[model samples]
Target: MQDLVNLKVISLFHSENLVRIPELSSATKLELINLAYCRKLLELPSSLQHLEKLTHLNLRWCKNLRFLPSLYKATSLTTLILSDCSNLFSFPEVSPNVRELQLEGTAIEEIPSSVESLCQLISLSMEDCARLKNLPTSICNLRSLEVLSLNYSPNITTFPEMSRNITELNLQATAIEEVPSSIECLSNLCVLNLARCRRLKSVSTSIHKLKSLRGFYLRDCSRLEIFPEILDTLERLRNLDLSGTALKELPSSMENLIGLRQLRLENCESLVCLPESFHKLKSLWFLYVYGCKNLVIWPDNLFSAIGGASLTGRVEMQKDLHGLSSLKELDLSGTNLENLPTTIKQLTRLQKLILWKCERLKSLPELPPSLIHLDAHDCTSLAEVSSITKLFEQALLCKDKPYTPKTLACLFTNCFLLDQKVVASPGTPKLQMLFGHMFTILKDYHQASPQRNMFTTCFPGSEIPEWFDFKSSGSSINIQLPSEWYYNRHSMENFPGFVVSAVVSFQDYFDDAHFHIRCECHLKSCNGDCPNLSCSFTVWSRRGLHGSRLLGSDHLFLLYHNELVRRFVETQASNKCIYKEASFEFYPGVWERNWSQCISCEVKHCGVHLLSAATDDAEVQPPKRYKYVS
Candidate 1:
């Protein structure tokens, strides 16, 4: 210990034990002490403060250390580290030179105002101190303090004069409701985070002029209504989010934000419409509108006006919408729409369609042949399966049952609709099966039998079918497509499901390659029937002449009779799936100018597990039948 003093080392902390400075006041040479991560040592000697040269001390991560010494006399100390000192509760007073201090994860609640005496301090990090509720007002005097991170400090609601020289600030998940307008005085400010400040309603109006700010966040302020006008002044802004706000419209001046490259409006449900001028965002590469349920329509010229830009990702719209022919992916299941527009055929790039719980839709229009995915679950009103069969080249059937007779018939007729198979797909085997199924449906099930009518006897509210006498207590109405059994050659569109209904049986010795059967049906009421009355029985037709090389059989079959098939195939193959992935990558940086846009963004993702394999094996002795190689 005598040798330690002669070396001019005032404080020597080796692990847990603090080697005492026996002649510390007399020597006057020792200036610092460090006993960081010392698990075995506990307390410091009270007499050590006499060594006036002692200026630096470190007792960080010492789990067992408890009490601190009185340092009112040692005025030269300049730095202290007590981070993760779990048992530490209080500390002694010292010189104002203590400019750098870290007490993170300690039991300290309120910092003494005397700390403000540290006039030369530059940085202070007190993160993760759950019991810490307030800061000393004296801290405002530290004019040199530039960095302060109170992230996850739920109890802090305000700061005093903290703007002058500080460049970075994070108050994520804090209780701050309003930022004082004086904040605009932060001339050098760059990054700010107020994510999940649920109670924050408005920002200081002068915030728009923070010319030095490059990044800003205001995500999930649920009740926030108006967007601050400060965005107009941020010429360098690159990203913005207003996902979960209550605000319904974007300011017309937003078009002037020329530097913005990413924008998010994920769940602003009150947003019923968008400004037509939004298409003028020439630099925008990504946009999101996933769950704005009340959003009824988009600008009619949305694509044409902005179509030249490289648009990518999920451009979400609410259900029941048939427009947006340029959108690559669509989700329309939760709404109350009965059908999609026939114009949907114009989208030649759609990849996925999700129609879940659309209970009112009884039939689907013909879909784009480009479709690779389709999900129609819980559509309880759907009785005939023919309408949805042509939509997907690959089907994900949720309800487990064999195809109904109607479905088989539609599949047989629409078999010719299959286009070129993807090169990566398995060869010939799937093609053969499709052709064989079509032949079986035409040869064996072509007989028009009313026995198939038993499936549709009861309607909603349990109304009996016409086949049964409703008055008889025991008579039950068989659910069937009510058959007129009597019709003239001219009018056939009067019945529901007429496009797929069995119109006529084969005449004996079928000679003419083409035959037409016209019918007129009469019913007391056309309930649960076609939405349009002028439907006609035009035979299915395909583009160009049907070549025998496309099929093994010499028979020629028409592809799709209704316009639905053409529309479905075109959109299903377009940009929908590809753009959804692009949107995910665009979200991180879009908070520069439009930080309020991502207030309500909630993404709906559907994942499908197409195949699962199970294997079982047992250990076995090798067979001796084969001769060993010599």
Candidate 2:
């Protein structure tokens, strides 16, 4: 042990029965000592302070440790970790050179007053320290400290003034009742978390002085009924979450937060209205206000707020809102009141607008050209939707620039007023090798618009669209691939895809308007093997849960594509294989026997057609199976 003087790293971790650290007064060259998880370690030698070159000391989970030597003599010490040390009640004095000190989940009841004098300290974390009630006020003078976390420290009721350079401050689940007005003096503060501070009733309005502040979280502050106003201070504020709070209204001066990007207010039962200033937050992108049952209508003059001038001392809100030009997403699900203001259409740049379960809504307004994704599901009273044809017009008109397409998924999942036309898809040689199937029928095959990749709506028809490739009149159909489909590279480069068509029997209305259809494709390979690929889809139509048969069959179509099939056929096909057989079966929901709607769906027709006339290079007729045999 005497020759271990030059040891730079000594790890005696998990030494479960280690009772005491050996005298290290002579290990002057040692830099790191890790005794973590040494559950029986009782004490550290006071001579440890003589290890002047020691830089890191870790005693994490050393539950039996009760005291540590004064580390102030270890001038080179930069990191000290004592997390989860249950028996330790006090921290040793650390050197001013220490940069990070962690006592998270420790039983330490008080911090050394010397902490404020550690000029080089950058981060001090003592989270989950239940007994810790207050921090030394001198710590506020540590100008170099950037992070101070006291989250889950229930006993901490008051926080002292903090350094202006602190970028993050976490005090979640604490007993703090209020923050001092001096908090605004922290101009560089970027993130402040006060979530679940139940007793926190008020905050200093001077918070606006934090010009660099970007994120503020106050979720679940049940008693915080009134929030202080920030006249015009935070220009860089971007994300603010006030979810589950007791807030009834937001201060009227939020318009000046021009850099605001997202605001979350979900489950705020008492919130009744949004400030007119919300409309002028031109840079705001995402706004979530779900489950705010009391919010019914958005003011017609959302761009104009009352006492607008008095709300801010200097920054005047623009008198106009030509749509939130930079806004991309907005959620207002689960509300009560009816129609949306006509001004909603002014959100010209909006990409998604979610309004699920708005039971009182009856009609949709004129949609914005930039609008793509929309969700209004479960609106039982909703009877009318604007013309679906115009939905794709704007997307088609703008194809020269980058655009985010509105999600085509479940766009009208439960809207019974809309009808739909169905299309079936066929597999190509490439598709046979790539994956199993491509729902080409559902993909926007005809639309040249880049933003409208898929279309979903309720249409009035049981017949397949006349534009389908192959036409048939049966519940099942078999089709062969064109000869030498894989030989020509142009087959995939120029070919759009095969179009399959089928008529669904919707004459009988089920208890639930939603239907599940599983399409299975069985391939009989030339190598005497058959493989099946199957997929399922959930589709909703105008068919009522309980309605008259007068509605007849609701025709449906979907686009299908798969990657595994294309790769398998191209490289795994048998040598003698010139032609292969493909068959498809459709089943409704969980019942395997009910492949078709009604007792038996009269197959209006089942057929496949090659998407392009590349027959000049490869014929559609089947070739001899033995053509390539030895």
Candidate 3:
């Protein structure tokens, strides 16, 4: 130590064998010392008090360390961290100049009254201090403190008094039963998190005084039955989550939060309905009410009020369901909704609507043209869907204009009622015409941008379509390609691609289960002059088919793969090699650890159809050498 007088920093981080540090008194110029993760170290050298220039010291993860020497004499110290010192029972006196102190994961039972001496402290964290029971009131004297976190302290039953300058306070997973009205003193607070506080019952109405607050989280407060009313407009509040609570209704004044952008009420089973004034939150773009089974009614003018559209009578209720123009996603899964308003199509910007397991919903109205994804899996009572022929007719009307393809996906797994109705009315244009119209739309989109267009659909079925050029009983199929099969010779109006289909069945039921169908392709040239070309693509299911139980039933899965196949063939054209044979293998893939148990999808049948611009009908017949591997 005497030879290192010029040392400005000393770091023995992660030195597991280190038990003691040599006296640092000789290193008078040292400004920082770190001995984090030194598990065997019991105590720091007392000579540390002599370093007047020492400004930072970190002893994090020193599990065996029991006590820290007072740092009162180190006047220059501004940051001190003793986090995860499991054996440490007492708080060490720190210099008043210290700006940050962390004692998280420690054995300290309480903060002493002397803590007021840290008048310059700006941040203090005591999270995961399970033995800690309370904080002294003198802590409010820390006028410079801006952040305080006591999360995961199970024994804490009361909120501590905080300074007026505080900005963020987190008390998650605590035993606190109520938020004291004194919380109003934190006029500058920006965030308040009380999530998972199972014992919490009520919040002070004075919470409205926090005019600067931007986020409030009370999620999983299972015992909480009431929320404080916002006596005044909380214009700055942007996010509020009350999920997994027992609340039955929201105060009508909730509409006063004009800037609110996201609201989550998931799993609030007791919630019956929203206040009539809820429609006034025009800025809200995301609203989730999943699993609120008792929720049955919606304000007649909910959507129209938000969009400033005109409202009409009951006969016109379905006609006036306009507005909510800024909303992009709406989830009403596991609810009691009986039917959707007809004019819901007026929401010109909505992109996704999830209604999984809404068993009471009997039918659907016309959907908005902007919708790109729709999931109605396991909707047993859903017997009719508004005519999709109208949508196709509109597309046909606009065929002369420059095409701009929109990606689309629709899932209807286990929709027995709807499938039974469609099967009974085989001549019905609703479901029967869908395949032809969808194919036409796909062709038009592919002709415009072969590399960017995609379409996917899943519905109840037991066999592959007869139009597919090559068919196989199992999962793999092989076919031969004629020379120049990649392009059409007659005109450049169509682009080359493949339409792949499969009939798959699930062996069992699993919650939140999902799997992807992986297609691995191998292409080889006739003369073996070019190297083998291999590529793969996946067809993913949306939202893990929530609540899906498709046991003993088969579903038809179809999708278009133009980008990969077209790009590969164009690159091969430059090689002047004739690719004559191609083989495709299909298998199920599970990517999530929890979903690994859901790998029971059996591919019963598979088929492939090739599209070429040179062919007048756009369908290329399979060569005589076609082979099938069962």
Best by lDDT: 3
Model 3 gets an lDDT of: 0.74
* For model 3, the run of ten residues with the poorest summed lDDT: 305-314
Question: Per-residue lDDT of 1-630 in model 3, one digit per residue for the tens?
Answer: 467689999899999999988877788899999999999998788878878999999999999999888789898999999999999999888889999999999999999999998989999999999999888989999999999999999988989899999999999999999999998889999999999999999999999899999999999999999877888888898899999999988998887788888898999988866777776887778788888876654566563211111122111122245335667778878876667767678776677788888776777778776676777877778777644534433333333234344455667777766555244456543343455556555555444442344456677777665456678988788877656743333333343467787888766734343556766666666665433334333333544424444455887788665555555555653344556766777776565754242357788888776666555453433333433544
Q: For residues 276-307, write the lDDT of model 2, one tens digit per residue.
A: 65667778899887778775334445532211
| Residue 230 miss distance in model 3 (angstroms) | 2.4
For residue 630, give model 3's deviation from the true position in Å. Answer: 7.4
N/CA/C clash count, model 1: 48
The 10-residue segment with the lowest total lDDT in model 1: 580-589
Instruction: List CA RMSD, all candidates.
Output: 23.8, 10.8, 5.4
- The reply for model 2, stretches above 4 Å from the true place, is 11-26, 35-41, 45-47, 303-321, 340-345, 366-373, 380-407, 411-487, 491-630
Task: Point out where model 3 deviates above 4 Å.
Answer: 6-18, 28-34, 51-56, 303-320, 385-407, 421-433, 448-451, 487-495, 509-514, 525-553, 563-579, 592-599, 614-630
Q: What is the TM-score of each candidate against the true structure?
A: 0.45, 0.70, 0.83
Misplaced by over 4 Å in model 1 are 5-41, 45-60, 70-79, 90-95, 239-247, 255-258, 261-630
Note the residue pairs that clash in candidate 3.
488-614, 489-614
Best by TM-score: 3
| Each candidate structure's count of clashing pairs | 48, 46, 2
